[model samples]
Target: MTSAVHYKTAWEDPATRQAWRRTAMFRCAALLGWLLGFPTWLFAVVMTPTWLLVLWLPVLWVGIWYTLLAMVAVTTLRGIRRVLRVYPWQVDIAEVRAKKKGSTQFVVPVPERPEKSVSLGYGGLLGTGQHFWVRAMKSGEVTSAWFAGDPRYVGVVATPGPRNLLWVAQREATDSRMSPRKRGVSPEARALARAAGARVGEG
Candidate 1:
């Protein structure tokens, strides 16, 4: 039998939580600024023919679209970097268990009503209905367990292995229990899993 290694999920520790809060606050502020500024800038561009001919509305729209896309891309990259910086530990998974239906509640900022909204709220707005519970073991003993709804993250758990037992189980669970609409994982996620050395089933 292969030895099991322990893994710690993101935002599990106090330091991680603090780091996440800082980064999240910054991100929210950036998002709010963009939300407020983008429309105003677009309106100015549309109304002011001196900036660009009003006849070139299509070009202006395309430019705006690409600019928004770039902003999103930059923000995503920064978030990824921040996450990596905050949680520097390499997670090693021992086993994974899949749930046909699972739910978890987490907190998120309500941009429109930040002052009125509570910081900690309920519901799985950011998560998928499906869940995978993963256990990481160290020295033949379990250390930590994490819940994930995204197949890609689940793939990360299944990556380090003497054998990919979790992948087999995941495939079986997905096929037998999931509805047709939610039967398969996304191609992108599957590809990512494969790249990370995790075995993934066909979508």
Candidate 2:
């Protein structure tokens, strides 16, 4: 949990934006999952006569499809609500105390607000050396967690360190925020600056 005094929600801009884009992509796969369900169901009916198999197939598909839909709705709304917002302070860091189920989930503890410990599963333990395909019930060992967005419900991300999307975005933002010449300013801006210099020299 490398929650720095500078972190808090300060990295929210990039975190939420990236989260939305990733969530959109994930939902696209969910759409595919939905479409494939028909064939998969047919296959189950034709190739597997076991009553238990047929009974569970649809149940599993519906569960996964609905879960993905819920995720899409949640992330999209959160992104819309706080995409442009930035925080310049600090707070308690969230913890990833669960496994990733094809996506990241978080659990942010809140014990003092006269309410339940808020924030739920998102990102999982990184550098855990565990194969992503392995469906382990446990999250292995979570050493660090970095979160962005609202701490209450919309904690958009919980990436473990050395792989923080917000950190990556921050670096890119830093590069972009450099001097105009270093960042390769637009030609129009250069022209305007030259004209301003000419006027100043004439004076």
TM-score of each: 0.30, 0.40
Query: Model 2, 69: alpha-carbon shift in Å?
Result: 5.2
Compared with the true structure, the alpha-carbon lDDT of candidate 2 equals 0.40
Collision pairs in model 2:
1-144, 104-122, 104-123, 105-121, 105-122, 105-123, 106-120, 106-121, 106-122
Model 2 clash count equals 9
- Which tens-of-lDDT digit does each residue in 136-165 have in candidate 2? 325545433554433332333434331233
Worst ten in a row by lDDT for model 1: 160-169
In model 1, which runs have C-alpha deviations exceeding 4 angstroms? 1-10, 46-51, 54-88, 91-199
lDDT for each candidate structure: 0.35, 0.40
Summarize candidate 1's per-residue lDDT along 1-203 as a digit string, tens digits. 21222224333434434544554565566556656665776687767867575556665565555456435534543433333322222333222222223322122222233333211111132232322222222122333222222322221122322121121113422343543222334566455434433345446
At residue 29, candidate 1 shows an lDDT of 68
